[model samples]
Target: MTSEPTHAEASQTGTLRGSIGVAGIVFLVIAAAAPLTAIGGALPVMIATGNGAGAPMAYIVAGVVLLVFSVGYAAMSRHMVDTGAFYSYVHKGLGRSMGLGAAALALLTYTAIQAAVYGLAASTLRDLVVEYGGPDIDWWAWALGLIAIVAVLGYRSIDLGAKVLAVLLVLEVGIILALSVAVFARGGAAGIDVVSFTPASFFSGSPGIALMFAIASFIGFEATAIYGEEARNPKRTVPIATYVAVIVIGVVYAVSSWAVVLAYGSADVAAAATADTAGLTFGAAALFMGDTASDIMLIMLVTSLFASLLAFHNAISRYVFALARQGVGPRSLARTHTRHGSPHRGSLFQTLSAVIVVGAFAIAGSDPVLELFTWMSGLATVSILVLMILTGVAIVAFFARSDVDKRWWHTRIAPVLGCIGLIVITGLVVDNFALLVGGSSVLATLLLVLVVLVFIAGVLISKLSAGKEVDRSEHEESRT
Candidate 1:
C-alpha cells in the first residue's frame, strides 16, 4: 500500500491553515446570498415587473435546478479541493485551456457582483444617513470607506470573515422572519391566498425574467465549493454547506415573498410594488409589526449589503490566489500572509480594482443605482450563468472518466440533467438580456461579446505559457 502523502504533498498548492466547519461555510455562502437585501431590494422589483404573485415560485424553481447541479458538484468535491473551484474542476475534466478560461470568467463574475453591491450599498447608506439628518456625502465616498473595511477583513484569516458574516446573517434573517411572523398573525389583505402557488399564476407573464432574477439570489450558494481548501473535512463540509445554503436561501426567499404577497392582496401586489418599489418590504412590516420594524429593516438592509460585499471580496481573493498558485496568472499573487495565513496579495489587488471601477462611475456622474449597480449586476448574472453551465458540463466529463465513487446518478444522470436545465436558463437570460440591464440591444450584445473575448484571451495566454515552458525544458535537456 502507498504511504500517506507528506503535508506539502497533501496540500499541493498551499492554502491557509483552514479549520472552517460546515457552519462557517454555510454562513459565508448565505451571507453572500444576502437574504435581507434580496427580500427588501430585489423581490419588490421582481414582483412589480416579473410574474407578480408568481415570484415566490421562481425562487423555488431555481433552487430545485441548483440542487440537481449540486449532486455532481458535491460528488466531485470529494476528490478535488482547490480554491479556484470552477477553474480547477474544468481543468481536470476538460483541459488546461478551458480551465484558464473558467478562471478568468470566475474572476470577472465575482468582481462585477461585488462592485454591484458597493454601488447599492453606498447609495442606500447615503439616503439613510441623509434622511437621519447627517451631512450629505457622495455615494462613492461611502463606497470607498466600506471597500477599505472589506479589504481589511479579507486580508485576515478566513475565520474572521466567517464570524463577521455569521452575526450579520443572523440579524438579517431575524428581521425578515419577524416580519413574516407579523404577517402571519395579522393575515395579509387577501387572507392566505393559495393562488401564489398555483401553476397558472406561477407560469404567468414574464416568468422567464422572474426566474433569471431568482437565480441571481442564489449566486453565493455555488461558492461553497470555492472554500473547499479552508473547510474541515471538505468532502462533507462542502456538500452539506452547498445543500444547506441553497435550501435556506430558497425557503427564506419563497416564504418571505409569499408572506409579502399575502400581506398585500395577491391581485394588488404588483400595483403596490410598482408604487413603492424600494419601500415594499418596509411598508409591509410597518403595516403589521409597526413603524419601528420598518426602521429596523432599513438598517438591516444596509448591513446585509455590507455582508454580501465582504463575502464576494473574499471569494475573488481566493480565486486570484488559486489561479496564481497554478501558474495561470501573476506569480506574486499566490503568496499567503505569514501571520494571517490569508491571500493578502490577492486581497489587495481586488481592493484596488474595486476602487478603480467604483471611481470611474463616480467621476462620470452616473446614477449609482441605475447605471453602476444595474449594469454590473447584469454583467455578473450573465457571466455566472455561463460559468455554472460550463461547470455542469465539467462535472459530467470528470465523473464519466473517473470512478472514484462510481455512483450512477451522481456520475451520469444528475449532471446531464443539470446541464440541460442551465442551457435552458442561459437561453432565457439571453432573450431578456436588455431587460436585465435596462439597456439597448446593442449594449447587451457588446457585453456578451466582451465575456466571450475574456474566455478566449485566457485560453490563448495559457497556450502561450505552456509553449514557453516546453521550450525552457527542452533547452535544459540539451545543455545536460
Candidate 2:
C-alpha cells in the first residue's frame, strides 16, 4: 500500500518536470489578483475617501517596499526548494516551530482569500446578471458554481489551470490597460499631468490607510515560490518569476492609477469619491468616456473579478496540499493524482472551504463581499505579509549556515534589507488592519487573534514533527 504512494509521489514530481516555463510562472503572478490592482479600484476610491491625488503615489510606496522585501525572498528561493512555500522557507530560515506558524498562516490566509474571492465573484456575477434582466441568482449559488469549477481545475495538472489563467490574466491586463490608455488619450480632465503621482500624495490617507490597501493589493505577487515544485527548473525559474511578477504588478498599478488620476484631474478626486456611489475611478471613466464607456469598464471590472476568484482558488488549494503533504492537515490531503498529477485530494477541500465560508457568512447575516473584503481578504494580506517577513528571515538564516552554494547578494545583505522592509510594512499594515476591513479595531483584534491562534498551533505541531516522517521515503537520501 505504501509502495504505491511512494511511486505515485515520484511520478507526480516527474510529470511537471519541464512543463511550466518562465511565461507560465509569470502568468501565475499576474492571475486573479490583477483585477484587485490598487490603482484601478481602491486608489481612486481612496483619493475621494482619504488619500487625494496622492493615492497613486501610495501604490508607488507599497511597490518599492515590496520590491525590497523580494530581495530576500527571491534570495532564499535560490536555496530552499519546496512547494511548501512560506512553511518550508521559514523552517529553513527560522526553525520547525516558526515554519509551522507560517504554514498555519498560509492556510488561513490562502483559504480566506480564496473564499473572499468567491464572494467578490458572486457579487459581480449577481450585478452583471441582473443587468441583463436575468433572475437574481443568489451570491452563494454563483460562488458554489465557481468553487466547483476551481475544484475541477485544481484536481488536474496545474498547467491546465495555468493555461486558462494565462488567457484570462492577459485579457484582464489588456482590458484595464486599454481603458486606462483610452483615458490618457482622451485627456482633458487634467490633460496628462505627472504631478498627480508626486511623493506628497502618499500622506493623503488617514495616516497609514492608503499604504495598508496598497500593500494588500500586492499580496499575490509573492506566490511565485508556490510554483517551485511544478516549475520547469526550481532554482532558476522561481527567482526569475519572483522578480518579474513584482515588477510587472508594480508597473501596472503605477500606470493604471496615473491614467485614472490624469483623466479626472486630482482636484476633483475627493469630491467624486464621496458622492453617491463614491469610487472615483468610475467617475473618471465617465468624465472622459461618457456613461456608456464607463459602464463597459464596469462590465470588464466584473469579468476581471471573476478571473481573480478562479486564480485565487488554484492558489489556496495548492497551499492546502502543501500543508497536508507536510502532515499538518488530514493524511489523505497528502495524496496526489496518478494521471493528472495535481493535488486531487486537496482539490476536494478547496470548494469545501468555500462551502464553510459561505455557510458562516449566511449564518452571520452578512453579505459575502462584505465578509470577503473586510475579514477574509484583510486577514489574507496580513498572513501573506507575515510570510514575506518570515521568508526574509529564512533567506538570511539559510545563507548564514547552509552548505549549499550561494552568492553574497542572494543570501546576505539583500535578504537582511528585505527582512527589515517587510517587518516595517507588516507592522504598518497590521497596525492598520481595522482600516483595511472598514471596521473597528476591536472586532479586527478579535479576528486577528483567532487567526493567529490557528497559525501558532500549526507551528507547534510542525516543530514537533520536524524530525519525523510518517510516509517513509523510497529514496534513502530523502527530498525536501
Candidate 3:
C-alpha cells in the first residue's frame, strides 16, 4: 500500500521559488500603492472634501505614523519571515486563533482593494477609449478583460510580475515628478506659499477625513513582507524593502500633493479642486507641461491602475496560498505550478472572485466609481487599518514572550506608539466612514459590521479546525 504523504512533504512540493531582491519587492509594494492613481484620483477629492490646501500635511502625518509602525514591524520581520506576512506575523505573535483572524481580514482587505481598482480601471479605460474614438464598451467588459490579463501575469513567475511592475512604476513616478518639477520651476501660481504645511492649515476643514484618505493611499507599503519567501536574504531584504517602500510612497505623495497645491495657489486650490475634482491633477499637468503631457498622464493613469490590479492580485493569491499551506483554507489552493512555481490555483481563485463581484456590480447597474469603487475601497481602508493595529499589538506581544531581540525601543515603545497612532486613525476612519464611502450612514455601518463578522468567522473557523494537521516545519526551515 502507498503511504499517505506527510504535510511536510506536501508543503515542500508547493514551496514558492525566487530570489526577489529589495528593489523588486519595493516595485511590487509601490505599484500596489499606485502613486499616479492616488494623486490624480484620491488627492483632488481629499483637497476638495477633506483638508483643502493642508492635504500634503495629511500625507506627511500618515507617513510618520506608519514609519513608527515599521520600526517594530521591521524587527518582527527579522524573526518571522514568511510570505503569509501580516497573517504569519500576527499568528507568531498573537497565537493561532488571532492569526487566523488576521489572515481572514488580510484576504478581505486585499480582495476588496483589487475589486475597487477594477471598478476604477474599467471606468478610466472606458473613458479613454471613447475619448480616442474606440468602441464605447461597457466598463465591466473592460474590467473582465483586465482581470484576465492580470490572471495571466500572476500565474507566471514572481520575477515576471516584479519586472512588469518595475517598468510601469518608473513611468508612473516619472510623469508625476516631471509635472511637479515644472510647477515648482515656475514658482507655482502665487509663488509657492508655505501656509499649507502650517499646523493651522493641517487642522483646517475636515482633517480627519483628509488623514483617512492619506492613510488609505499607503495601503500597499506594508505588503513588503508578503514577498519574503521569494526574496533573497529575506531577513535583511524584507526589512529594507519595508522601510524603502514606506519612505518612497510618503515622499512622493507629500511632494506631489504639495506641488498640486502650489499649481493652483494655496488660497485657490480648494476652490479649484471643488470645481473640478476629477480634473484637478490633469489641469495642473496641462498648465505646466502642455495638453500632450496631460494626455500622456491620462494613459499612464490607466496603466497605474493596471499595475495596482496586478500587484494586489499577486498579494491576495499569496495569502490564499499561505492559508491553504497552513490547513486553514482548501488544500488545493496551496499547490504551486510545477514549472512556474507560482500559486496558480490561488491566482485562479482570486480571478474567479473578481469576476463574481464585478459581474454582480455590473448586473446591478451600479456606477463603477461612485458605488463599487467607493464602497469597496472604503471597506478595504478600514479593514487594513484594523489589521495594522492588531499587528502592532501582536508585535509587542511576540517580543514580550520571546527573548529573541529585546531592544526596548524596537520591541516595546515603538510598537505601542504605532498602535496608538493606528487606533487614532481607525477612529477617524470609523467617524468619517460615511463620507469615505460616499454613501448613507446605514451603508457605512453595514460595511463596518461586515469587517467585524469576517474576523469572528475566522476565529470560529480556527477553533473548529484545531484538529487539522499543519506543518510549520517548512516555515521554520526558512527562518533557519
Q: lDDT scores for all predictions?
A: 0.88, 0.72, 0.93
In terms of lDDT, the best-performing candidate is 3
The ten-residue window of minimal lDDT in model 3 covers 467-476
Evaluated with TM-score, which candidate comes out highest? 1
Across 287-346, the per-residue lDDT of candidate 3 in tens digits comes to 999999999999999999999999999999999999999987789889887767788899
> For candidate 2, lDDT tens digit of each residue in 1-480?
344456656554322222687788788777756654455566755666557777777777777877776777776777766777777888777877888888787778777777776777678778878987999988878877877777777778888878888887777777567768788787847677766576666565563666677777876775688778788778898888878887888788878877776776777656666673234666666766678866776776766666666666666767777777666778677666887767777778877877898768867777876666568888888888777777777777777887574677767877777777768777877777886776688878977787778877876687557545544443455774
What does candidate 1 score on TM?
0.96
Better of 2 and 3 by TM-score: 3
Q: Give the better candidate number (1 or 3) by TM-score.
A: 1
Q: Rank the candidates by lDDT, best first.
A: 3, 1, 2
Model 2: residues with Cα > 4 Å off, grouped in runs: 1-18, 205-207, 276-279, 290-292, 403-406, 463-480
The candidates, ranked best first by TM-score, are: 1, 3, 2
lDDT of 2: 0.72
